[model samples]
Target: MRIRSNTGKIASVLIVVLSLLVTIPVAYAGDADALAATLSSGDRADADKVRDAGRKPAEVVTFLGVASGMTVIDLIAASGYYTEVLSVAVGEKGKVYAQNGAFVLKMREGANKNDNKELHRMTKAQAVKSVTDAGFEIVAEGEMLRNSEDDRAAYVFAEGMRGNTDRFVLKSRKP
Candidate 1:
């Protein structure tokens, strides 16, 4: 009877120790609050308003499965609006490519040059800087659709209302 009791106590202690070991990794993985705070700080005022108005950055980030060490591509990242937010979500080990189509340059070249120029001015370097400032290395700029599949981004944020609505489309490797 004493032997059985001793064995039961050892099993209980083992279970408790095993549970603590399992939970420690999950606790240390990431802090959502810290990430959110970083996002709110670097984000623009209007973008914050837009985020507050309808979109939830944290939710969107989670839905996209963004982690600490993944690469993302922002399609037609106008004015680096979502770039700032994505940089914060992906963290230091992650990267973001803020791409623009040729249409942006072409449109900026003609009659609407003044307005388009301002748009490009705000978006160009700032987009790259945002990720770099967040401790990510920025890749070369250009269109994403033209890139090879391996060089392609893991996630794509398509701006405007035409494609994929307001949500980001995520691409994952098949197991």
Candidate 2:
């Protein structure tokens, strides 16, 4: 579905698809509170703590349905801020891989600094088609992250692509 922003600049898409095959709930209320606690923990670096306001790691992870004991990967982990959060969220049972360089380079070969590149573009229709084409059924979809003022054509981070860009999430599983 196309969601238009209030300003109507341009609809930034945030798609989420989940397969009914999985019976597990996306997130538990307790888990969300734990994630919030993780964000406020003193173990996190002071610098990283400050970034929480903008990054909203807890909210992002919660929206992604990241729960305890779920393996997760933080590509382009940078300073391992997310890695730490995932590790704690996943507890000792699950694993969190924080990787960069070649691994990240491959997934983002043509991605520009501003994170705006045609090569990385995908319309909502195309995204759904791709998921179905992969033999998975999309059971759930969500517009968790949408920013209309986001200029997808912008070519540099200096232009404010950090939190200004739209992000989509999808959940699917094999039939």
Candidate 3:
């Protein structure tokens, strides 16, 4: 009887421990999904297709040296493609700055004359909200082609014509 009682107690403790382990991972996965959703709403199918075709967001972010709580500045954040991913990777403690060029906004305005301005405005607004929602704050805005002496960006990510190979330039502040 004593041995049987001890075995029963051990089984009950094991069940409780197993239940906790399962629950923890599920909660973490749910949070990750929520963060991903907040970053991009575009047909993930399309993003996946694009990523598969060339560079993936995960790879790009890794190349950019984006660490949690570090500040990242994204240049020419047209349509917030990379902005969403950066926000999620940075988590709640980090910051992501989405900057766009005047030429890009003007081009967007020219392409869709009817709603270009509205769309451009909406894009910037949404990009800001996307990062903020993912727990990041916007630090500054500027053009990618133009260099600012005091930009002090921990890392700068940009989309070039070719692909992800040369699309990013990582910069560190001088001590």
Candidate 4:
């Protein structure tokens, strides 16, 4: 897909798809807290809700610095699991490109008729590295903290550790 240039920004903001939390930033900490509740909300289907234990959608979005009104590319969006959560996170103004892989398409052909595995096939690790290498700075290190919201936040973090998971966030460096 051809991305049109917006204000000549060098593809700075990275919306990572960890399939996975931030604790460091005081301001954004509340983001993780609030979003975790949304992820675990009754709004989600029972089948999808139960998977939160393993997927940790809230934490992943927070760590990746996702917000409302930003276009996100949900690479390898299997069964559109992350895609659903991202849609909520990005709100109506934002858009999510839920691109899945060929293997995923074949496995779940009924999922989407336009399935093309080659569409956005980069691995999560590669995505992280590419963003960082492109001069994207990690402005914060996310950790789910303890508080009244600890239970929900912890549910999002799920034994938080820096290197314990694949989630990441980065921003473009100013030239």
**Top candidate (TM-score):** 2
Q: State the local distance difference test value for candidate 2.
A: 0.54
TM-scores for every predicted model:
0.41, 0.61, 0.38, 0.49
Winner on lDDT (1 vs 4): 4
The per-candidate count of clashes, in order, stands at 0, 9, 0, 7
Quote the RMSD, in angstroms, for model 2. 8.1
- Candidate 2 lDDT over 140-164, as tens digits, reads 5545455667656663244456554
lDDT of each: 0.40, 0.54, 0.39, 0.50
CA error at residue 105 for candidate 3, angstroms: 0.7
Better of 1 and 3 by lDDT: 1
Encode model 3's per-residue lDDT on 128-148: one tens digit a residue. Answer: 454455554444332222223
Ranking by TM-score: 2, 4, 1, 3
Stretches of model 2 off by over 4 angstroms after superposition? 1-33, 74-81, 99-116
Q: Give candidate 4's TM-score.
A: 0.49
The model with the greatest lDDT is 2
Tens digit per residue, CA lDDT, model 4, 61-131 = 76666677666676656677778887777776777787755654554424334422223233334545665
**Position 15, candidate 3: lDDT:** 13
C-alpha RMSD of each candidate structure in angstroms? 23.1, 8.1, 22.8, 11.8
